[model samples]
Target: MSSPNELPPAIFLDPWLTAEGDGLKALSQTIAERVERQISSNLSQSARRDAISRRGLVVENLVANLAIMHLSPHLENRDLLAVATAKTKATRYDREDYPKRLLSGVVLAMEELGLLIRHPYAFRERSTTVAPTPDFAATIDRQRVKLSDIGRALGAETIWLNARTGEISFADRTPLKCRIEYQDTEETILLRDQMERINAYLNQSGFRFDGEHQGPVCLRRMFLLRSLSDPHSFNLSGRLFGGWWQELRSDRRHRITIGGERITDLDFQGAFCQLMYVHLTGKPFPGDPYAIEGLEDHRGGAKLAMLTLLSRRGDLKRLSPELKAALPRGWTAKRLMDAFTRHHPALRDAIGKDYGVELMATESRIMVELLLTLKARGIGAMPLHDGVQCAASSGGLVAEAMQEVTERVLSVALPVVEKPVVGQEWGYKEAA
Candidate 1:
């Protein structure tokens, strides 16, 4: 066993184990034997081991399900392996070899079979860093099918991946549409079932990717599923952070339609800023949370600054050259901060004081409540971080749900900004 300060030994990964190589059956037996040894009770060890072995199989099944349905098919098999073999975050590495005990043997076995690939460095890559040539790259599609069969044997009933293309049904086997370019992690696997459930629900509830847009409606798709994650503290607010919608052009979003009726976007004006002000002052945000008294011309910067402050726990550096070039004149980070402080003195003083995590938690709770409420009403709604969208006729219900959750959780009702459907004029007024 290594000391607490020492790093865990590197383990090469192969998430999709080959049938001829270190196969699933051998891996299962190994896990069972290891788990059995961990059982310390004097009670009939064989019987207890058998029961625990069944549960371990269930966990293995779940992992396979995640790989087939939720994990991005665009990623190389080695990347997924990296997630499973990644280092532990727990502090008791001095005494316990939890992660290594679970993975090291399987990794070595796979390495011997020529199916494993070690990361270039000790740590896992955040994105698809490997560009394996054809000779070195394993058949990802074949591996997916093999994993799916494993899942099926373990009782997973969903058939989301195509047999040949290895694509999820949500994007209709379209390349790159369902690709998860992010790093492989346990959290990524944990989110797969929820994503599958939601995608299944959307398909069952009459949601379709309308193909009338200039881009592939599938690629230019508007996925309504929550990533269940965010950089601002990993909140589950149904934020479109990683979805294709975030990549959609603003002019083209209005083209999203459901059942032949045009869909409209409903925004929450200065959402995070308003939430922070309300949380701190116990009073509604004074009109236009983004409009600072001294920076009226730089509403964009004021909004951006407010977001930057509320979303993180850190000091504000004056705008970098890259950031400065992206914004209009007079919109430096320093100027924006000054304006933000002037307009909302109490809230400004509270920025970057370790308040972001709680705010995110609160926001996530409220969004989950709203989404559940809408789901119960049989009205399909797409979350937009701060607000959600349904049919315009069902707009009132969506608004009511948003307000209810906000008030119930925050004890205040912030403004809800609604955008009208194209060729119509019925959205909430934009904050001046």
Candidate 2:
């Protein structure tokens, strides 16, 4: 949306995609060489060579970094691929020292070459953003630069433990969450290898949105993401991310295609609570767990309440706007929390404690096992954490496979819910 005629939103960095691209690496090198040459008179030979040869500014790596940025807007809706450039700087993930030094130089060089227009990033909070200039957009069209030209970072460090937790800044200039870095262990490495295999299988699943045929498949690569709460533990809410379908609305996602075959949406019904219920009782939830007797109509509120009660740490202070809208008028989050506990006293001791990470960890294992099962049977699945997606024709089989995997992992078979395709009026709430 760097088009001069239309204003673009300020896109903050997303954790989903790294700013790395290998396409046009040679072309970028040529451009970087020219850029250094244009400034050659300003610095002597030794200084120029030293600057260019510095680790972060290595021409090829730096330009590929730019090329990914340049190519990103084309592959994804620019809004969907928000990567924090700050994290890229001085982090273990960016071991090469790329992006720390090369961003401005690449942007300026691209501007000079009329490849892009830049809105300077306010150093205070936002990362710099860019868009291809009209000429560059035209160039992209002419050369047909595309998704295959870009991908997950080359070395495939597909597992991450992020330390910077909160997003907002405090008035006194204190960061909301102190940043920390984590070291990897053998377990994390094993998860990374498993993810690489899954990614390899999924990347070939022929993913694309409806009505498009010419780009590389999406979510082909994924990473296991966890907060650095326990750097040594891979179990702290390790979720799989990096799928394009993840960015879609449910209705829109129904349009996804694998090898041009339309897909189906399936998930474990009420999975957050179901996982606990079944694991605790050794039985699937008896009925709609969110349907508290007095709050039968407040399923959403009940859901929000149960999630906060069981998953979040500490006290319930107030209702989020979404929760508030779902509850009875004048209900407090604390009131809802109390109501949830009163109805499900079995979970009383678990309230006010953090189980979100545990749930996700368990859910991650289930999803992985489900995907592997499907893979062994030559059926493809896209990991949706508590759910998965497969060709519509394969939905029943995927659902069955998922339940079997869940039963194996948790000793209870949580029901699989089939979400109908776009035209369907209603989806089945539980697998028959």
- Candidate 2 structure quality by residue, lDDT tens digits, 175-242: 24443456777876677777777777887777666545323332322222334354444565667776
- Candidate 1 on 1-432: residue-level lDDT in tens? 222223333222323221222344454445445544544446576876655555454334323423332223223232333334345453311113123344544434333444344333333223111222232233334343333234222112121111112333332222222212234347534444444444444434433234331111111111221222322223322232323344445555565555555565666666777777777788677787776766566566566566567654456666645445545676666775776787788886787665554555566556656756676678776665666656666776677677777788788766676765455556544322
Taking all chains together, the TM-score of candidate 1 against the true structure is 0.51
Q: Supply candidate 2's per-residue lDDT for 40.
A: 37
For model 1, the superposed segments whose C-alpha errors exceed 4 Å read 1-203, 212-243, 293-300, 320-326, 330-332, 420-432
Candidate 2 Cα misplacement greater than 4 A, ranges: 1-91, 95-99, 112-124, 133-135, 151-153, 163-180, 211-231, 292-302, 325-330, 424-432
Choose the strongest candidate by TM-score: 2
How many residue pairs clash in all the candidates, one count each? Answer: 0, 4
Give per-residue lDDT, candidate 1, residue 349.
70
Cα TM-score of candidate 2: 0.76
C-alpha lDDT (0 to 100) for residue 391 of candidate 1 = 68
